[model samples]
Target: MSILLWQIEQHLENHLACRFGHLNYCSLRLLQEKDMVQGLLKLQESEKTCSGCAIGKSHRSSFDKEIAWRASQPLELIHSDTCGPMQSITLGGNRYFLTFIDDHTRMCWVFFLQHKSQAFNIFKRFKNMVELQSGYQIKKLRSDRGGEYTSLEFSKFCEEMGLERQLTIAYSPQQNGVAERKNHTVMEMARTMMHEKKIPLKFWA
Candidate 1:
């Protein structure tokens, strides 16, 4: 065990995915199959769990499943989320990111921002671009009660456009599961890939 640990530490990026990358079992296997990793083919079969991964990934108890409602057509519903104040600024000087997902198609769009205040403007641009390209008017927008979404101007704009608003209950992220899960998945993949490539953190943006 000691010798194996030493070997992995000596070539961490090339040999392992758990401790340094926080990658889950599925990601490790997928990367391995793609020949994107090397030198630790035996490690994945270990019965012991990776403690570092457990500690880093620990989360609160799961919530009940999402509501039974589903969107039937594109532009019928949209899920939006913001994630940010990252530990490191990206090479592009971004500190945060926003995501918009079409509930029906599950198509996602991402926009980078240097400040949270930029969310509203970026959202407008996203709306215009997507509506133009998809040839569909957005019928509803769903998001948490963030200041960007709650602002008077934002509310008025939505009203004027006849877009229904669906705000999640306070402190209840599970109600906005679509956007929340998308953000989590995107960031997790980015972290794992960056670690695998030994890429600099600043490029994460």
Candidate 2:
């Protein structure tokens, strides 16, 4: 037993020297404090150029907070986003879904699609349906500058309808928080319900 324990300690020491020595002292200390890792005491602190560590530690500055825009009436401003190409296709063959949120009412609409190219048509249908029901014109449309939203046909349609287009800055989803958060909420709810019910992946539509 003593011989086996000594061999294990020796192997751990060798592993610490070869694989974990380059880690910062703080990380070594964390490993020592954790119950899952053994032999952290044998690790030696050393200054090493670890590119992965440097990159992992780097982050973009937080975006400045601003007063959120509020709509005076329904259909005044709408936020939209698309999420998907899920790992499993739905029974309806849909692998993508789009969401639209009315700013004033906080009302949400979801549309399923097989391809992203259907986004423009779906938006058109949503606009007509809502406008007809509420008797209010859509004044503004807000979304990320995805290809589906920025397509020539979509742009022309919005222009003809006199709708203001609000596109978030490149790589900045926070600017479209309403739609982004709605998609997150929808996905999380779907995942939770599916998990609890043991629903099959193909029925996710």
Candidate 3:
């Protein structure tokens, strides 16, 4: 049998701290007190400060409540987001829901899915139904750089359709605020309705 050497001292303090999401001083100290990592307390030396933790934990100002631009026509732009792994499953066995909002009309459509992988296919289905009904070709799509939106298949499909993509900055959901707020509003409404009617959460979809 081979034995592993933790070599806690050989590793840099910042690296270890980052591994546990840049844990705070108390957290690190607790680890030492619990002997989770023997000698880990040495890294807490005054000289070994974590810069990443300082930067990452820094607070940013709030986003503007109003959007600077709005689509001039229906389907000019679509804001989409996937929300879930709900606390309870839907009637169709779905635990997730994806939403697409028309930027100009503020119209929102939702689709349920059992897995996140179904998101791309649901987008295609939504595109087909809406384009057929509205007779307006979607010019752009906006979403976070979720794997469902960034997958090779999704990118290729958008390219083939000549659709523009707007991705949010890393860790910034405010860039996709429309979809985020829509989901928030929807959740609040659903919860309020369930409370009023004594409906179960499984009907959230």
- Tell me the number of clashing residue pairs for each predicted model: 0, 0, 0
Q: Compared with the true structure, what per-residue lDDT tens digits does model 2 show for residues 1-205?
A: 9999778866665445335423455656566767447644554443343343344333323434447769999999999999998889998889999999999998899999999999999999999999999999899999999999999999999999999999999999889888887676566546544554567878778
> Which residue ranges in model 1 land beyond 4 Å of their true spot?
1-64
lDDT tens string, model 1, 67-164?
77889999899999999889999888898999999999988998899988888788788889989998998999999999989998899989999999
User: What is candidate 3's lDDT per residue for 49-136, written digit by digit as tens?
Assistant: 4444344344433444664799999999999999888999988899988999999988999888999999999999999999999999
- Model 3, position 41, has a per-residue lDDT of 38
- Regions of model 3 farther than 4 Å from truth: 1-64
Q: How much is 46 displaced in model 1, in angstroms?
A: 17
Residue 170's C-alpha lDDT in candidate 2?
Answer: 98
How accurate locally is residue 29 in candidate 1, as Cα lDDT from 0 to 100?
Answer: 65
- TM-score to true structure, per model: 0.71, 0.68, 0.68
- Backbone clashes counted, model 3: 0
For model 2, the local distance difference test gives 0.78
**How high a TM-score does candidate 3 get?**
0.68
